[model samples]
Target chain A: MRNRMNQRQECRLTVGTLTDAMRAQSLLSASAIRSEIVGADGVRERREGCGYALTFSCLQEGQVRRILREAGLRRF
Target chain B: MIYLDHAATSFPKPREVLSEMTRCMRFYGGNPGRGSHSLSLAAAEKVYACRRAVAELVGSRHPERLAFTLNATSAINTVVKGLLRTGDHVLISDMEHNAVLRPVARLAREGRITYTVFPTMLLEEGRSPARITARLARLVRPNTRMLICAHASNVCSASLPLEVLGEFCRKRGILFVVDAAQSLGHLPIDVEEMKIDALCAPGHKGLLGPQGSGFFLLGEGVEAETLIEGGSGYHSLEEEMPAEMPERYEAGTLPTPAIAGLLAGIGEVRRMGIDAIHAHECRLIAHLARRLSYLPEVTLYAPQYQGSVLSFGIAGRSAEEVGLALNRMGFCVRAGFHCSALGHRTLGTDATGTVRVSVGYCTTEAQIDALADAAQRLCRRT
Candidate 1:
């Protein structure tokens, strides 16, 4: 479990608003991509306006971006 | 205590429902689709799961088509006020509860729409489906835009022939709306099989969920005007509400705790199987009907087994008096018109509405026997 956790990386994706961020999270979940809202100090410093960020595993980063893009979501 | 008022709202909800609701309030306290934080994500997951559960219960392929509402009244209002336009005619059965009747009546009184109420006698048992279909066929006019009916009457438990009506509507391109308030969890409803355009159901009744929880299931190509518009947490920049399935209908902060409870309630229903619950309730209804029919002074309004509800009155005593006596004997039953004056008018009980005893999953055979015995005793006093 430690090795698997180490392999996972956090990726921050900026959304238009908090709602959009949540919608993105739901879409990603439907595609079996596990993600959570970004809460680290570095991520908080990066959040702009009402936009928010999320983190996911590095292995699923590509698939997550692809799904978010298909859902008309943009990354900061 | 024998609580036979399931028709109003189910009591003693499944243990899982209460626990799940408490968990939601304590742990997942976030507005669904309002934020991207972990708590919000968890809350969103619970809401989506609830949507899926409601969709599955009503046999809808697209869970997104289901929209959460405050109750069945809101659901029916969303469909009625949103769909019916000026000069659009509607056909409804005379057995509808006030939830459906009042709104439609208000619209008719406003001259926005004209409605006709068909007699429930056509759908009575032993009546030929062909004859009933023919009668409904003649009632349809060129401007008949929709046919709305309650799946089962709250007053007498008389059920409408949905399959026949659905087929009739499909052939005529009329929208078929069903108020499944009393029948959702008690019977099997297949939207596809019945060609239902929309279904309005409450979670607290047969679904065994908390009050203030219900949903409106919209079939494909069915669209209704937004009843209340505000923040849907989507398309924030746009001044207009998003033209989407659920978001278009759900326009405010949803009751997350109630929805969580509804998810657990649906889970319990699925686990027990709708057929098993129906069988159990039907057995109780049959037993109660048989025993009540034997009393000379007890006038059973619905002597035959219709569904889970049984309405009766004593020959000389008013329904309220009997209901009070039953309450003194530790029986909780619904008295009066049951908010369904039209149904009482149909049953010729508009002057003296019958007492209603509605059974649920928790109701047992012993309770039914006790209720019958109490009714017999009340009759002897009269």
Candidate 2:
């Protein structure tokens, strides 16, 4: 279950739940977009009471965000 | 051990089931849907994959609508308690397990609703879908909000015609719920084709998964009150679980290792096709039934139905005695009511509580022959 993830990636999408992260991850995977879900410990990951983010190495930020939004993912 | 108690829970699970569970505990033992680390997400993905696999196997298009629960009993409680309301009436089959009966009975005891026992053609000479539907039609009332029944009896081979009952419920605007405890992996189920409002099944039995894994799959247009409320990994900002399908019902962290085992179990079942598994078990039951029928002391119930389970008793020895004797002789069989009072009463085994022998996909002809010979010896002693 080992995966290569860029922890310092610039493109990161923060989601509400683990299920949402999984959904967004699956959608992005199907679209040939590689992303990794990590603990949302970043300042941007802070919410009222949540902490799970999906990180991406994509240069095209718009497309990744678009896929996340299209999949109805609740993001920060 | 010659385990024949599959109706209780499958034993000697496939190597894949055992290996996957060990892998999950070792590699990704995080709480599913509870965390966001690599191990957590990996576990979450495995759980989702299992849901998708189950949905596909049961012909449910909405994998998200399938929620994992402790077992079929908890799922049935969620549905029966969540959906039923005051002034609502329910109809249950005579062969329903306690899972279906208890919740419905509790609701009725609280006087929130009422229920009627609809007879099934367990012993009728010429049973067919038409006859079964006609009998159900006779019991249907305008206030009948739901029809909860088992896909197959837990103690015997009698199974209801789900397609016919589903159509009847749809026509009457009644929710059709099925308890597939004894039939999930052993019989064909199409939630979409059957028009089932809710389908409950245990992963341990026919699916060959370990204990502690089961699922509740909801059909379109079916909504039930949240039976339990807690931290749904998502929507913690709000007090209510989100209106989403799974997150709505799954209030707490899911069982990851058991789900991982279930994923492997489903893989094994798929490797041996559903039809092939069912036919193999039924063939074994048929052979055993044929052999036992020759003994004048033996009486087989629900012999005509083609399924993985069969029930019988010896005239001289009580079911408890026979079950113990079989155990001593290295043949494992379940005796007594099997938690299905309604089923035993309907099948006329309430007094004797027939000894139940449930086969599985891996059960062989040699095992059936051995069990048959043991049964014959028991009969001869009588």
Candidate 3:
């Protein structure tokens, strides 16, 4: 019983550590996206807060268009 | 031809309101209360200034006593959920919006608090304030801790005589909460003179602000528990919520751009003057109600001297049918119960509901004329 409890606590700690790392990485990448030029920055950056996941690389134009579309931006 | 649903959400917000919101989005864009840098400080200041403006408008001495919520509904919930415990009794009015009724009803069903509702209509139109005061004086029980009411009805725009109600609550040593979502910026409110313990209002309705901006003002010495406990950026060591007024009530990141828009909106309202706006809207509403009453098929609800809102029914058509017909003619008005089901039932308009036409500061006399013409045409058609 003691061993099982210890394993659960270790698993929780591991998950928490991973979450913090992901948050830090996203924050850094979003800043890079804002600062970097629109095109030719192969790593396409995206700005998202809290519960967002980066499924595509920062440099993908298709992914950028998809993100903008999903955000309800329209062509005038 | 007209948009007469200001009671739901005011349209065509002041141009400066949009510009200020855009400016916040373009620059000084930072999470308020999250950092001590210049950008964060500017964002925080923008929010604080709005709190101060709201406090001054409502006659609150301290701006920090106000807390921001998504809307008055959530603000009322935050207070109702935070304050009441098991076996507590409350007093309410017959004209309350569901924002107050639903939460209180649920709590009553849960056995947390039971309540009594008083009818303000007994006072009559142009009735002396003392009549309403006498009615309320008879309703207060020993166990009653709070008396919450809508200062103005969204359905009919009939304003409750707050001076009498406020004094009644004061003399009984009970707390009084006023829902001012419909009349805060459009009508002059003096919380100090009114003896209002708490007021919940939405920024989008009469304040000409963007969506998701609203606040609650609590009187001194009336502290409700914090429902959401998290980082308020004030204390890093403490695990529990802070015991401060707004800081304790405000948890997590606030909508900074919304607050910026709210500050700009309040400035425009202050420049125009709430009394002037109230007079303008009342004139338009009274004109529209008078014209509608002249139509043989029209059945107007509430007195002709109500505020900016007017509710009516066509003898031959459903409220929804008439509303849609008006909409087809380029008019926008709200139909149905307006979220006051119990009140509608009490008034015997539950089945068909009432068509509501509410005006705002930007609403012109010509628009009211057009609305009256549309109603005439619809009546002719039916």
Tens digits of per-residue lDDT, candidate 3, B132-226, equal 66777787777889999988888776677787778888988888899998889888898999999889999888899999999899998888987
TM-score, ranked from best to worst: 2, 1, 3
Candidate 3: which stretches are off by over 4 Å? A1-76, B122-127
- CAPRI tier of model 1: incorrect
Clashing pairs in 1: none
Report the poorest 10 consecutive residues by lDDT, candidate 1 chain B.
B120-129
- DockQ for candidate 1, C-alpha atoms: 0.15
Give the winner by TM-score.
Answer: 2
Report the lDDT tens digits of candidate 2 across residue range B1-382: 7989889999889999999999999999988767666777788889989988998999976677889999989999998898998999999999989888888888899999999999887888888889888888988888999999999888888788899899999999999999999889988999988989999999999999999999899887789999999987755677777777787898888899999999999999999998999889888999999989898999898788888888998997899999999999998999999999999998888887989999998788999899989988988888
In TM-score terms, candidate 2 sits at 0.92
Write one digit per residue (lDDT tens) for candidate 1, span B258-285. Answer: 9999999999889998899989998899
For model 3 the local lDDT of residue B24 reads: 96
| Candidate 2 lDDT score at position B218 | 89
Could you tell me the TM-score of chain A in candidate 2? Answer: 0.71
Q: Fnat per model, in the order given?
A: 0.09, 0.38, 0.00
